[model samples]
Target: MAGPGVSRRRMLGWMAAAGAAGVTGASVVGTRLATAVPAAEVVTRQEIRTLTPDQRTRFFNAVKTLHDNNAANNQYNRFVLTHYNFRSQGHGVAAFLPWHRKFLRLFEAALQRIDPTVVLPYWDWTLDSQRPERSEVLSSAYFGGNGTGSNRCVTNGAFAGWQVRYPNLHCLQRQYSGGSTIGSWYSPGMIENVLNTNRQSYDQFRRAIEGSPHASVHVNIGGDMSQMYSPNDPLDWVNHAFVDLLWAEWQARNPNLANTYNGGGAASSNILAPFGVTVASTLDTRALGYTYPRWSGSSRPA
Candidate 1:
């Protein structure tokens, strides 16, 4: 792995590696290099087809299309749960990330094919600091409701620690707070199977949004995009471009602290899906290599 100080040099190597061979029906999305051109030369924004006032409306429509198509194309879409049991389902556990990773890749690809250079956005919950529930961008496609509505509360399953597996599970109003490290590898001495095999997932997400000048992050609509998020919409094209950005942030801030989790703790079969695997029975994010950038001055596209 390239050290923090040498990422820029590594990125240049990636760009050269990508161009070494001939180009056919290939995608440069996951390439390690963050697509770079001098800032002044980058055409960051695509032509906004819809009026500024109708941004919400337009995004909703596009998301609706994504969900509907994903469901129609894959039989498993109906079976996939919103938050749990996904990794252990039909395919072997390892197939989980690669499968969805491929799915998300195709999903975003389709979006871009329709509109070259349109990148996947992400949800930066911090911006809505004043009112945790009511952020500026609200669409049923990904983010579920009016910030003031009933669904705003997180009220089910693990929220109520009824399950013996997750001792911390408890049902309460849906919270947009920090320390949501349950399945997240923010604990101590946990095995990180995913990060171990593939650390480049970070670089892949970084390059996918090469030309986008701002973060277009948003929430998974209908609480879980897996269920189509709507009656007619089946495939959910929900993705956060800032996933990489956040990882970088956390890595930088807490370099000494990996995602710390306790081990030997058994989780209910139900909740296993949210977290990909039971690596080391519990895994830590820092050891696995991840961080969230301070991101104070980062820009969000208009």
Candidate 2:
């Protein structure tokens, strides 16, 4: 890893050189670094369930603080609007993964600004694929359960009765696809298969993951989550964090294909709007100052 103050371009150049020189070793993202980047600077995003009680409290508190701001120009609403405005360019395209990767980093930064100790936690829906409604994530103790009444306003959890402004003023809501229960999600085995099948192609991998498992979570969750302004629901952050983790895992598994971005004529130089960062720059998660917990075999880190 490169030392502090190393530019992303310089680090990427070093990585390219290391690859060309056939350098290899055990490292956080499965790719050995040719230079030193501080380990402490790279925070590991843990699974939501793995977070301690205090950590959960801090995370939720920071999120609620942003929610409470509720100003038209608030950072939280800025994120929701950004996602809504860029929906066409960000979704169903080769840039989907990279776009969300950058977006999540920005959202996480906002939360961290309020509480530096908080790192975005991911919801590993694979763990709840069997009975999503019964998952602890939806319990009142965490994100709260389904919305009640005709309006479908969220009446529980950290964001209950939260009002949002995008297209109009409305309360945050959720209507599970299966009435009172959310339908089953993709299994760990299915994700493992996705990782294996699209090992060499970024486009194929993006398509497979985005079209199926990724979309399933949003669709099943329904209401605000399914709309263009999905970011209105705080679950969007954790859910996308999980999606980004899967992409990172795929990249780590295929070290030689680290910068293998393609499809839709999307070059590594193409800029991800709103951030002004190139696709190539977002390729390495560690270079962007974060990584998911290291894991082995077919299972994700708990």
Candidate 3:
């Protein structure tokens, strides 16, 4: 909000505000926290934690509140359409990678808004690819039995690396079972050029989070049909949060990654700046910095 460098006095004022927020946030825990042990270091496992049938119902219902629609997926609807329709004349630019990132981000924010204590647990695909990557949709992995709804892996690619070929994890060979739209959520590449193509290893992750992409654990926006960015939509909040996590992970990996997402251009949607937050908004990672994360606060990133 000020100059390139904020003074220590300004920083203190912000911290003081964060401390008060922590107090108010403590009152809303799910009680389940006291009884539940944190999932064992599942980070490397990428075990897609499926929400239980009950959790699934709750999660879906919550998402509907924001989108003003029911069951975002239709029988013929596939979130993975990005890989096909972009740039009719030229080869698609990892088409799906950007759109799906945004959709999932919106999807997850809808989830957390309802349950602040909830964290969108990632389904570690590395450990459980055997269960059929298609079966790992959040609904099934977390809760079990959504019936292998969609496909995530692909049969074709330039490199065997799942990250590179699938980008955000989608391949033409991968098809959604409940009609074709199911596999659409998987993204196809380095996403934005700055994040993937133009950075040092560590900064690469942080920069990848441009504009409305990275809304949730795996939720990234894919289709970049229009350049206009509007914060009026919840997707804006969702995308930034998703990117924030990736940056957090990047920071963890390098510990010294250049912690910022400040450049803007035709390539950079830079959706985050309009909201007036920082690369590290959460003393714990809060969006819009409205409320910092606290004991039970979901706004704070883990």
Candidate 4:
């Protein structure tokens, strides 16, 4: 096992080993990996709406540590700013999904460092698209409801009274548009269109998803959720996790193109700082050691 991170030299060696492992007929079309090395942990990321009470506790506790622990790059707001500063490169480019995948993996790794039992959970926004506010994950017992007062600061739930020191000192806030009601996000049909279509390359799929639900959800949450520092709200993790899930599903559906990377920067381009993973190494989620929960009798958003 490579532990929390792998050096570039070591990763290149792994890639060479993978290339030399085999060259089946599938390899000609880029459909399969030459080597099928298993990852040490096969963590199954579940839906946030479905997490058990204990699971929620573990998640919140890890986040609390990350938020309060100044030793980690000067608390959590710095992490949010890390993403904010590099927002352009990660979005609307070939690196969108892979960059976020690497970010989440690093964040999850950090969480595991605090509480090894915690794995990142996803939010299937479509499942609660019709009445986003009423979703179980937003209840006072969970992530809590919208903010109150002039600043629109969240005053209830796990993150209540929390202070952050990036993009100005402020409390974690959210202003649900349309009078505390978030409009419906992308439907299952829209997602199906992306999955069913022949993307031809990675950039096409990246643009499609990034334009619709991805941007839509950001606007839906408004306030801090819409800014470059969206990660200031922990819910962004689950939101992006769903995006990553979409990517994983798309990759699984089109095996031949699963490993494809095109447009924007080159494959060797660094995927932001803190994470030394190259654009190419982030292609295979299995190689990264985790996966989204598989959908059954469905193409996307189970």
Best by lDDT: 2
Better of 2 and 3 by TM-score: 2
Per-residue lDDT of model 1, residues 1-302, tens digit only:
32111233433442233223332211221222111121222222211221243553444444444334332222222222221222232122222222333333334444444444444444443343234334333333334332123533432321221111111121112222221310111111111222233233333322322211111111112222212121122212333223334433433444443232122233222123333434322222223222222444333344
User: What is the number of backbone collisions in each predicted candidate, taken in the order shown?
Assistant: 45, 5, 40, 0
User: lDDT tens string, model 4, 1-302?
Assistant: 11112233432332232223232211121111112224467878888867788998999999998788433244465557556555555765567788788888777877877787888899887777677888877777777778788998888888887766555667778887566787666667657777777478777788677665676676566667766667888888989999998898888988888877885467767454445568788887777778887643243433
User: Candidate 2 at 225: error in angstroms?
Assistant: 0.2
**C-alpha root-mean-square deviation, candidate 2:** 13.3
Candidate 2 stretches with Cα past 4 Å from truth are: 1-40, 263-267, 295-302
Score each candidate by Cα lDDT.
Answer: 0.28, 0.75, 0.28, 0.69
For residues 32-76, write the lDDT of model 2, one tens digit per residue. 111222335889999998999999999999988876766766667
lDDT of 4 at 188: 70
Model 3 agreement with the true structure over 196-232: per-residue lDDT tens digits: 3445543244324422223211111111111111121
lDDT score, candidate 4:
0.69
Q: CA lDDT of 302 in candidate 4?
A: 38
Would you estimate the TM-scores of all the predictions?
0.34, 0.84, 0.34, 0.81
Best by TM-score: 2
The total number of steric clashes, by the backbone 3 Å criterion, in model 1 comes to 45
Q: Please rank every candidate by TM-score, starting with the best.
A: 2, 4, 3, 1
Count of clashes in candidate 3: 40
